[model samples]
Target chain A: MRAHNLALVLDTVATSADPPSRASVAAATGLTRATVSALVDDLIAGGLLTELDPPPRTGAGRPAAGLALTSAGPAGLGCEINVDYLAACVVDLTGTVRQHLVEHADQRPAAAAAALAALGRLAARARLAAEADGLVMAGAALAVPGLVSAGTVLDAPNLGWRDVDASALLRGVPELADLPVVVDNEANLAALGELRVPGAEQTFLYVSGEIGIGAGLVIDGELYRGVRGWSGEIGHVTIYPDGRPCRCGATGCLEQYAGQEALAAGEPRAAAALGIALSAAVNLLDVPVVVLGGAYATYFDRLRDGIEAELRRRVLTAGLAPVTLRAARLGTNAAVRGAADAVVREVRDDPAAWLRRVG
Target chain B: MRAHNLALVLDTVATSADPPSRASVAAATGLTRATVSALVDDLIAGGLLTELDPPPRTGAGRPAAGLALTSAGPAGLGCEINVDYLAACVVDLTGTVRQHLVEHADQRPAAAAAALAALGRLAARARLAAEADGLVMAGAALAVPGLVSAGTVLDAPNLGWRDVDASALLRGVPELADLPVVVDNEANLAALGELRVPGAEQTFLYVSGEIGIGAGLVIDGELYRGVRGWSGEIGHVTIYPDGRPCRCGATGCLEQYAGQEALAAGEPRAAAALGIALSAAVNLLDVPVVVLGGAYATYFDRLRDGIEAELRRRVLTAGLAPVTLRAARLGTNAAVRGAADAVVREVRDDPAAWLRRVG
Candidate 1:
């Protein structure tokens, strides 16, 4: 009960639009004033929260000090290994990005081990910069463009990766060895990052267009990872049935038409092909919104019209209600930032775990 | 608390393979024996459960009476209006069909009111039969081949229906005037019917192939209705970007290739087209199982191979784990049976509602 109350108080302060006093928190939570004060004190002592300076005395009695999440507390390390880039960032408890680093290189030709080593170095630099700002590293998460399960990259056709044990390889790096690490699909993480967008809907489809096209399904404010943790393979949804061949042993896949490479090669039908594939997703899942991320964000103005035209023609409910379309606010930084936010959320949801680890 | 315990005790008895005594239920739920006995007594008095005959005693002191769901309690009325047929059935608390009636005639040419009147007559016959067998009708659910929201049939292109108030239409029938009625998509109801299949997975995609093709997504044992109660429009998913024209004002929709009319017209590419569209659904949703219901069940042997070929080639996770394919166990009766089952489930889940009405 004590541990639960501690997390509740911290989360309440973290989500508040304005710093709230102990009296307000107690009223918001329906907890007694004494209990709220005790939990707040424990959170302050654990470095998860801090009391803001009180306002200058007005005509009333003593003014209560407002509580807020500590900026110099535990932070999260986020790393991403995409087909052509490596990136890392650190996010503090106050939802601030303290450090970020990126390197551009063609990763498809490099060995998986070599690519991971480079990401580890970038993450190390970000972590050192965060620590210098008086923040402690809590954990780390990596975003990869493929099917991930049990710390393994099951397959990343774009990178020519299959059955690679990413966690074991990352643990071998001196900088990332000490931190607990997890691997997730890049699109899934990007969707999570978009979940924090101001006024974002609780459910929508996030499409990550890169060298490879992938999608993440957000349902009821949570990522809907399908059975076996392999869903949102929108790139492989057949668009033509007899068009271009794909490396995934299929013909007429959406990727062969709409992937970044296809767009870069001046494929005039990229937008139309994407619209065809997205219509299938919308028809089947009834998702109300579609947010184009990754490379698509950069080309939103060019692609939106074609996608909407197809949607208006193919979606069954197009006449009743139009599916909302938007460009991702975080753009290419979504996956890395979401990865770091996930780690911070862990600390906020269960502060007692951090408390025990620190002790 | 009492209402919750009553439902829990009733559900425990309904789900048990072998009848269990109050003491056993108490042990399973961690409730005191006296409390379990009182809850069980209330359920029995409400006609939701009955004490089964005790087994022959051998060495024990006293054989405790086992409890089971009553077969002659509240029942559900299910009705379906398809393109060429109308069906109605009654299902009792024991999950047994007590009455069923079906009429075959093309409903597309008839006025919507006339078609509904014919269905009302059929449902009245079934309801009379169930009442003769001492079963009380709890509620009614009607299945239509289109989008339904708050008792309104928004659209069913095959039947040429748009914004039809189904609840008001059904209530206008004298025999059904007193019962509460709801309208739902046929595919969604059929999926719920398949949920009772032995060894059914908690998550799956049920395809209802008729004059139009629709899909029902079942995740975690509940139907995943999309944002506006208008999901599972698989027939409109594009199979070929520029193939045959469809009545829905779209070109190359799955319905143009795989619908019953296409098969009746001897479209040689129906199976392959179905394969392409279903591949999109499986890849996007990652549903592990696909159950072919409605017209597809009658031709599963001929369609299975073509569908499987496309799935293996298009699904990203096919190499790691193959998606299972099966024919609907209930066959053509799945929609009507599921509609009735939905009503029966409501009573089982909340017997207090029935008790209050009966009193």
Candidate 2:
């Protein structure tokens, strides 16, 4: 009961636009004022929350003391293993990045073990930097471009790895060995990263462009990982029935059109194909919004016109809620940051569990 | 506390294949045996549960009496208003239909008030039958062939109704005035009906073919109602970008090829278009199963070959989990049954709320 109430209080504060007072938290969560005060005190003592001066008011009673999450609190560690680079990040409880590092090294040619070793080195640097800034690393997660289930990379044809245990790869790294480590699909993490934006849509599709395109679905503020945890395989959707051949042995797959390799070569057909495919996705899912991440974010201007033209033509319910396309706010760092955000989310979702461990 | 625990115990009993004993319920829910017994007693006293003979076991010291949901308890009322007819049904607590009635009348040409009046008459008959069978009518829900939100039919193009409050339409019917009523999309309810079958897939797409091809997406056992509660409008997807003009002002829409009218006319292109569209949905969502309902179920043998041929070629991860296509088990009654199930689901999800009212 205490844990549930504590999480309730924390979530109320995190969601408030203006820093919430104990009284407001109680009103929002339906907890008593005294209960809210106790939880707030415990949170402050744990360095997860801090008291702030209330903002100036227009006409009201004395402004109550404001409460906000602390930037120097327990942080989440995130690592990413992509085909072209390895990256790491640390995000504080307030969902702000404090430490980040990236190294461009093509992992496609390297052995799986070598790529894992390089990612571990990057994670150590981020952890050290976070510690120096008085932040406790709560947990770590790795994002990989593959189908991941139970912390194992089931298949990553892009990286030439199959049935590899990603979490086990970091067991020898001292900085990560004692920490709770998780592995997930990169597209899932990138979608989570996009959802971290304040006032984000409740349900939207996040498309992540790379050498191959991928998508992650966020429904009702939660990731919808399908059976076998391989739901968002949008790259293979047939965009053209009798068009170009694809690596997946299918003709005119979406990846062959909208993937980074196609876009990097500055093919106008790539943008046009992306628009047609996205229109189908928009029509089928009825999602009101779509966020473009990875390479798409860098070329939003070049791609938006084509996508909009197709959407205007194909989406049947566009008049109900015009499908809005937006660039990912966090840009290319969304996956690594989303990885860190995933760890912080654990503490936010069940503050009682974290409190129990601490107590 | 008692209400929460009671709900836990009742849910465990309802979901278990064999009626679970108090000890088994305690083990499954992490409640103490005493607490489970006390909650079970409350449920039994409320006429929501029954004590049953324990199943025979190979080795057991003392066989404990098992618990199961009472089939003659409160029943959920479901009413549906379609383009072609109106339907009403009552389902008992054990998910069995106790009373059902269907009226064959073309609603498209009728005035909204007259059609609603006819539906209320049907709902009255079903409620009377349920009460005669020693069952309490808990609540009623209306399913319409259009967009619905907040118990209002937002826009049902087939019926030419817009911005109509369905609950208000039933106010003149004394049998339903005081009873809580809900309105929803027929496709959403149909998908929920399909989910009621034993051993259903965790995540799959349910396609409802009628005048237009509608779809409902189920992910993690819940309907994926997208933003504005209009997620599965698969009918609008462009099947042949240049084939046929549709009412929605789009060319070669799936509805033009796969709607009931087209299929009734024996258009081979209808099955072919359905296959292509289903392929796109299956590939993009990575769902391993697809259940065909409405008109599609009647002609499954004709459509399956075309849909499967397309799936074999388009679904990229078909090798991971073979896509299984099947006819909806409940056939034409899925919508009405699902509407009733929706009402019962409220009780199953929150038995404590019902207990509070009863007490």
Candidate 3:
């Protein structure tokens, strides 16, 4: 727990692009000067940070040395593997995406293994780029479009994956074998990516719309995985109990009501379907924000009204608060951005917990 | 905060019907001997607790003195004002309902004031009864049926109240004028009352059925008041959206679909309507418990299968855990019980925060 707090302190300091000093760190963290010094000493000793050129002493006062992250050491690798393509990026502890690579797979279920292999190639290319930059890749992050449970891909109709042991398959990749690979549902990873963004902290719903619609929720600053880690199948919940039959055998499921194809052909935007589906969700949790990504962003400008109407119904007499309905700023690259975030989490927990366990 | 904790300490040990010793308190709270000793001293200093003859030693140590609540000081009070009647109770900080009284009102718009006056008389009688037992009530609580907004009764259709300042009106009753009186929706209070019951901490959706259909959500050990303090209006959210104009000018509200009148008229249980209503609530919070109360409890058993089946269609999935459904143990007295809880809360907050501002 203390290590995690210290890691947070490190993140707070490193992410402060203004550049932080001892006094600033102490002020920002509300920690005593002594405590900040102790933590900073530990961080420097670990080689994660180094002394910077001292600030110019304008007056008859002592000069203060600044701190900065070192480009040296093993960096983290983030990879996004979808049905049609694979992408990987290597990032330094400071969240810089130093290296990136991409590949495409033939659109067929029979080519899943090749797709994964293509991901390996992308990861290797990114790793090589990092090494060229004099930074060794420390760990690997693999994100997939599917129902992921504890690092395993349960099903991915879009990718034709079923009963796939994601952890095992990724473990067999030569470059990733020596480097730990963390796996998660791409939507969850994307939500984390967005959450880590400088200013998106309030509880809200995140909907990822690629071939399928999946949702991830952050409530009161924590990700709510729900009972089965699938609390957010906004795609499957019945919007119209008898409207249309879905592949999952449910009639009028939200996917059937508002999937990418449905919205692409329908009168309203994807946000409308999300709005109707989430009106109930928002009312229940009182979440006031919705972030849309993937194909849905195409029709969001058109569907804003429907979403707002549903939101209005669930709110109190004071009316619903204005919820941000912004399109994913990173667009189609959300999955890759999410993977990068996973890498950061890994580096934070990696040293201690990783050292405590082995397969 | 400390009062409630101390009450819980005494109430927990009080279950044995034996005075608790310092060792027992330490065992109950999982606190160290020194901490429990300190708390016990604080309780003693506040005159809320007393010491008794030592209980016979069980193990191999010196006999330990027993601790118990004193016969003096503030206690809990709850009052529920229904359309036709009023019920009141005085409970201790430990939740023991020492006195209960009830009065019926004449069926008219102006009769509510008369009913309250009668309630005051009954309250006085109860106080006389408590005086017989040497207990002085510290405060009072009131629950109303309405869309209560910032201490104003926005509307209580059944009681013919519109824009009534209930807090100000109730102040005319001198017995309660000097005492702190807490007022809230009956459903919210009932949920709190149920929460205070031993082992009811598991998440539960509370349904109150009287003049209207009301729901209270307890998620993860906290009451979710929602955005406008006006959430849980299950009665108002449109169910059919196209069927039956509601009193609130909406079409197909849950109450319109599954209300008592609808049920008695043999409206084939609209599980879809109710399930959709609650599934939306459950999806947002992801809690796994539901309890039915008031007039609705009698029929919840009959509608369980249909409710679960409908919920399965929209909320529950193949592997996600199922939310448990139960009837409230307090039966119809939940509002009164909740009132007692409100009293406990009032006495617990920093007393200075509660002390009326002196002119």
True contacts kept of each: 0.84, 0.53, 0.17
Question: In candidate 1, which residue pairs get closer than 3 Å at backbone N, Cα or C atoms, i.e. clash?
Answer: none
Candidate order by lDDT, decreasing, is 1, 2, 3
- Model 1, A84-194: lDDT tens per residue? 899999999988899999999999888999999889989999999999999999999999999999999999999999999988787678978999999999999999989
Put down candidate 3 lDDT per residue, B112-210, tens digits, no spaces: 566566666666666667657766566677787766767677766556766767665665677666766666778888888899888885567787766
Model 1 lDDT per residue over B1-359, tens place: 87787788888888888899998899888889999998888778877888988889978598988899988889999999999899999999998999999999999998788889889989999999899998989999999999998999998899998889988887788999999998999999999999976677889999999999898999999999988887799999999888788888889999999999988887889889988888898889888999999999998998999999988998888998998999999998899999999999999989887888886
User: What is the per-residue lDDT of model 3 for residues A1-359, given as tens digits with 9 covering 90 to 100?
Assistant: 55765665677667788668888888888887888787777766665666788878898978777777766644778888865567888777776678767676544465556666767767877887788887756667788877677777777766777767776666666866777777877777777777767678557678777666777787666677754565566676556556777665456666775776677677354554566566555545455677877666666677677777756653334242555567666566666777876776676654344223321
Task: List model 2 lDDT by residue over B225-306, tens digit each.
Answer: 8777887878877776666888776777888989987998988888767877887787667778899998899989899988
Best by DockQ: 1
Best by lDDT: 1
TM-score-wise, the better of 2 and 3 is 3
Q: After superposition, how far is residue B303 of candidate 2 from its true place, in Å?
A: 2.5
Question: lDDT by residue for model 2 over A1-359, one digit each (tens)?
Answer: 98788888888888899898899898999888998899899988877788997668867688788899888878899999888889999999999899999999788998887888889888998999899999988899999988887988887867888888889886557777878899998889999998988888878899888877778888789887767678677777776667688766667788887888788888777776777677777767778888999888998889999888778877866766688899999898889999999999998888776666666
Q: What is the lDDT of residue B16 in candidate 1?
A: 85
- The alpha-carbon interface RMSD of model 1 comes to 0.7
Each model's lDDT: 0.91, 0.84, 0.67
> Comparing candidate 1 with candidate 3, which one achieves the higher DockQ?
1
TM-score for each model: 0.97, 0.78, 0.82
In model 2, what are the clashing residue pairs, if there are any?
Answer: none
